[model samples]
Target: MMVGATIIDIGTRKALEANGASIASGALAQANDASYDIVSDGGGCTDAKFIISGTFTTAPTENTTLAVYAQPLDIDGTNDADAPETTRPTVFVGTVQVNNVTSTQYFELLAENVPWKANYYLHNNGTGQTLSAGWKMDVIPYTSSPSA
Candidate 1:
């Protein structure tokens, strides 16, 4: 036996300032063992839905950049050399990954329960080839957390 389902529609609520929507876009960036910022690198809002999509320049080989939701943290007490790297503290609410490097293959990560601290990052681990990519994020603010 199973229970019934319930659904709600969240239309564009421009008049509702607290529940308004927003879009964040980025230009194409080339990478080779480099990281690029996609969304709020150090800031985010709860009760919001995020749709992150992007395209790559060429078909990456077996190893390519990884799309992740992580936070930056102070590694050491005082030394700048001891600071955490760009893609440090990989704390993800969901399994995030970029499947391939093909131009036709784009990556889309849907994060809903994203905390107000996590930031989106794209890590390109390609050794030899440089891959060009661009990313976009659609943020939908909500009054309360949405159901799964």
Candidate 2:
């Protein structure tokens, strides 16, 4: 028997900033502080795609590169908020490059091959650029067939 691949939308396009505040330039912050829990699908997620879309409030002086990362919880399913500072580690998945970004300009980055983990986080590469108040990131995980 073969099961069709299933796609799971982690958080329904959750905003990078929880409070609807602009992400300041030269700052590194987590996307909603592990907002989307990837383990809810019985931990069968094998691959994922990171979708980031939003407008830039403050454009970068030069070409800007935004990097996305994923931070998984401990093997015992310990949340970052409860784990020790030194136990959590983030893995670099991919990046989006914005050239000549302008205010109110819409941009979208679709990064593939992002491994499914316990959780995820978004990091802005601090290129003197700020995302408008409504930036959003969506994580879509693809589950492999049980018999595959």
Give all TM-scores, in the order shown: 0.42, 0.60
Candidate 1 collision pairs: 60-101
Candidate 1: worst-modelled 10 consecutive residues by lDDT: 14-23
TM-score winner: 2
Candidate 1 lDDT (Cα, 0 to 1): 0.36
| lDDT (10s digit) by residue, model 1, range 1-148 | 1234444333231110111121112211211222212233313333444444545454444533444444423325422222224334355433334455545343434455454432333334442234343444443444333445
Residue 41 in model 2: shift from native, Å?
3.9
Instruction: For model 2, state the Cα shift of residue 108 in Å.
Output: 5.9
Per-candidate count of clashing residue pairs (backbone under 3 Å): 1, 0
Error of 2 at 75 (Å): 2.3
What is the lDDT of every predicted structure here? 0.36, 0.52
